[model samples]
Target: MPHFVLPVSEVLVVADGWQAEPDAEAVIHRAIATAAEIVEADLGEAELAIMLTDDAGMRTLNSNWRGIDKPTNVLSFPALPPTGPRGGDNAPRMLGDIAISYETTRNEADDEQKPFDHHLSHLAVHGFLHLIGYDHEKDDDAEAMEALEQEILAQLGIPDPYAERMD
Candidate 1:
């Protein structure tokens, strides 16, 4: 059996100016699970944090870190080292962190007419993939990554998010 070792940091769910839904915690857990499967990594020892924030906080972060000055649905900072094999934490492999904008997620879900859980799940999985060094900057990369995400999400009983886009 697989094992997951996600120790969530408190800042991940600070929830300032955001009223978390009843199943928000479950959504985070499911995201962690989906990420573990997608990356083919043993999650039992994964140590990471997820931050859920409103648009203001996310916008500030985006501007400071990425210089985008906009609230993105999700922003990921991977902890893996560059120019070397993955795994070099020396201190439990922190796996960096993922910051998700609650405002963006909620608005996107409302616009898409999908469940909040579904949209949140997609972002969580998307962020997790980034932590493990997955990027969708190119067509080939996007297809491969989306396929992996679909497989992982399906394993978690989620519909294929890319199906409609492909059609």
Candidate 2:
């Protein structure tokens, strides 16, 4: 089997609400690492940022970037490809930024009766997929993305997040 490389991820906890999940950062890191390995793309040496924020912060970001006035559980901002020459041979490529809302995630997890960390891992994996140009705007795309997410999560001992809807 071939070895896969994981990206360099930076987790920023910007909201006090995120403190409720003390293992949130570790969960994100583990999700991203597993995702990078499972994904077909070679993300070695790539970089990305994960921002843990509250609903208010998410609302502001969503409004400013997507023109959505409400808060979302997770949002991904993919970085544009570099247009110029590389600064160095070892420079890491910028993948993108992922922002997650604490309150929204908590609510969704509670409502779905799923473990908080499991849901958190799902969102992180979903956001990371977006950074790598995987989108679910279409039915086919959604299926493919969700399948991949299930595979990655399964490797992490997480159950299918879409199992309820499938039934």
Candidate 3:
């Protein structure tokens, strides 16, 4: 029941570095859908957008929105106030946008020695969690979020994404 909108901003190759996996969009779509399912999102009347871009595009977004002036792996913009009731029936809720930088994602994948698709899927889930108002800004929040992420990723037959970094 999850509905998604592919923007004119579908995918942007603004850098000359890494090439993406074959049918990359398909991988993203599947991951996003899986994340929504794991979060029990009311996807029947909700719409989400995912923008695949490079470091340059992401840097611009980061500078303009967060004032950080640097590229990060993913950025999430939630469309509605999380405390309020969702949109009415038949009105598709705008869940906001998730922008991912190919440069950062690929570089992190290489550094972590994880498969590109798996890493990308993890980022998508992370960003989706942010869209749903989940944040890791606190230790308790981090624990909850990480546990949910591990469970979700496991259901996808993916290995524990945080295991390598666990203390």
- What TM-score does each of the candidates earn? 0.84, 0.96, 0.82
Instruction: Let me know the TM-score candidate 3 reaches against the reference structure.
Output: 0.82
- Give the Cα-based TM-score of candidate 2 against the true structure: 0.96
Candidate 2 Cα RMSD after full superposition onto the native fold (Å):
1.4
| Stronger candidate by lDDT (2 vs 3) | 2
Decoy 1 TM-score against native: 0.84
In model 2, where do residues sit more than 4 Å from their true spots?
Answer: none
lDDT of 3: 0.78
Candidate 3: segments with Cα more than 4 A from true spot: 1-19, 82-89
RMSD of each: 3.5, 1.4, 4.2
* lDDT digits (tens) for residues 1-167 of candidate 2: 43766788999999999888999999999999888888858766799999999999999999999999999999999999989887778888999999999999999999999999999999999999999999999999999999999999999999999999876
Clashing pairs in 1: 3-44, 4-43, 4-44, 5-43, 5-44, 12-50, 12-51
Candidate 3 lDDT over 1-167, as tens digits, reads 53543221134434545354655567677776677667775544566778778899999999999999999999999886456665455466677888889889989999999988889888988988888889999999999999999988888788998898678
